[model samples]
Target: MKPGALALVTGANRGIGLETARQLAQRGAVVLLGSRDAVRGEAAARSLDPDGARILPVALDVTDTRSVAALAKRLERDHGRLDVLVNNAGVFVGATAADTTAEVTRDILAVNVVGAVAVMHAMLPLLRRSSAPRVVNVSSTTASFGLTSSGADLAGDASVRLAYTASKAALNMLTVQYDRAFRQDPDLAHIKINSASPGWTATGMNGFRAPRTVREGARAVVTLATLPDEGPSGGFFDEHGQLVW
Candidate 1:
């Protein structure tokens, strides 16, 4: 996405999402700062852009189909096109495999996987209208089957949560699928979709125990979100470069 591009970031009220929105705004993209709570969203938007020119608050609950549709309709009516979409809304439910329940797993998938796809489906039309569109799915190192299955003690001990890891793994798959769809569709070939890992960041999602700062974590998102026309898609990456999926 270029300067002045239109962008929307879900779960932008805080953490990596908030930092990503701020960075996008600094690059001159008009960003819709999405949060489940409208008040908190507005507060976040203000913090990103005090003049209310670059960052705008939006009430978006990815798990709510109606809310997702409503926002898409509003964006279509106002902007008519979306240049960037950052699916950053996710939940962390730390429970070991033995402690994980069906309900908990289902709930995690609903938001982390289904919700991101829902938003993408709703915004496809608007995205198609743009000459160049980018979609970034926020993922995690815990989602990497290579790392986890290999007994790599990466990310952290909190990553043992089956529900959270599984959700992100599914999300990474969805990102690849979406990228494939765009490549196969002639009219949508310009659209790029990639999964980005923020690494372990110190945020509420992890009790702020992680070592990375929000800015450090958001680099991957911003990089892929603003990729040039030649940038790669359907790959998992972080600030460092390509990552194991």
Candidate 2:
């Protein structure tokens, strides 16, 4: 990552988001830890960097357009441009497809799909100011149809999370669309957009049942967020390499 780069990670109060922010800070980027709750966000930021050296807590509720706009405005005022954005804020509500309802699906989409798009739209102007900007959408392997249908162990178990899986699949498409649109535009070609799967981390979203640690889950996100100008875009990747989209 570039020194003094300005980065933002949403839902950074805990779990993979928090770890991503920490890693970015360690790489010399001034990271904005975004959370829906101001207090928790501040606390999380302090925990990562007690001296307030690299982390700044910001109240950002991606689902709310007003909140998203407010954060954009603040970023423009405080920092001329944003170099990286990690759309890590997501929710997994329903346990199984059999028990999932329309409302639950809507709620999941609102945060995982719609909310992520909102944040990206609002942050585009700021990102445009940077020489090289990157966006990493925290996706999941559960979104992969190839794996799900291949009778893989993880996919077989994730099949029960209908709402989460569908939402992430939508997010993956959103990443592709954004990358395509940016690449087609001469002025925006430098912007890289990609989706990442953290490989079933033990986060609150999963009741802490997942075996992977937060650091392990955050590696892929940080890698995409800090990609070079020539890095691949419109791709779904994990820590190892590109994943089957």
Candidate 3:
């Protein structure tokens, strides 16, 4: 994104989301650090930007339509436009296939998929105002059928956490679908949207047991969030490059 560009990252109170917000602000963008808890969000923003210059904290609960709309209205009032939107808010709960219930799947999907969609819709107006808008939906490689079927390392993860994996797969599909929809509208045709799998990262989600650091995990996400006009849309990517799955 251009310098001083406005960016919003959900779930920015901790983990990869916070790292992404920091990286974006470091690159000279004005970032909104979103958190469900206002107090945590404020603390995070203060920690990142003590002067309260670029990094601003906001209350945003993607699952709550009222909360999403309120945040969107505030953004429109304060920033006028948004150049980058990182849908990094997500939830993970481990459960075996047989152990997963419909309620569990629904709950996971509610945040990982539905909530992200809600945020996108709320931010569409602000995004449409940008000359080059970009949206990155933070996803996971475990969502890949190709990886699982080909006996890749994430194969086991894909089979075990049925709800989490399935929700991410659905989120990836949303990226493609949203990109296609944008193409039909001249105002949004230039908008870039993609799924960024941060890969395995040491975050609170896994009790920090994962090998990757938050900085490493946020790399791919920031890449997509700041994609150039010529960058590919509707693609799944990691830090290296475009992912086949």
Clashes of each: 0, 0, 0
Model 3 C-alpha lDDT per residue in residues 1-245, reported as the tens digit of each score:
79999999999999999999999999999999999999999999999999989999999999999999999999899889999999999999888888899899889999999999999999999999999899999999888878867877762355458889889989999999999999999988988999999889999988888889999999999999988778999999999998866
lDDT of 2 by residue, 27-116 (tens): 999999999999999999999899898999999999999999999999899887999999999988856767888888989899999999
* Residue 236 in model 3: lDDT: 97
Off by over 4 Å in 3: 155-159
True lDDT of residue 20, candidate 2? 97
Please provide TM-scores, in order, for all candidate models, with all chains considered together. Answer: 0.98, 0.97, 0.97
Q: In candidate 1, what are the lDDT values of residues 1-245, reduced to their tens digit?
A: 67889999999999999999999998989999999999999988887788899999999999999999999999999999999999999998888778898998888899999999899999999999998899999999888999887888786785357789888999999988988888899989999999999999999988999999999999999999999999999999989999888
Tell me the deviation in Å of residue 96 in model 2.
Answer: 2.2
Worst 10 residues of 2 by lDDT: 151-160
Best by lDDT: 1
Predictions: Cα RMSD each: 1.0, 1.1, 1.2
Better by lDDT, candidate 2 or 1? 1
In model 1, which range of ten residues has the least summed lDDT? 153-162
| C-alpha positional error of residue 156 in candidate 2 after TM-score superposition, expressed in Å | 7.8
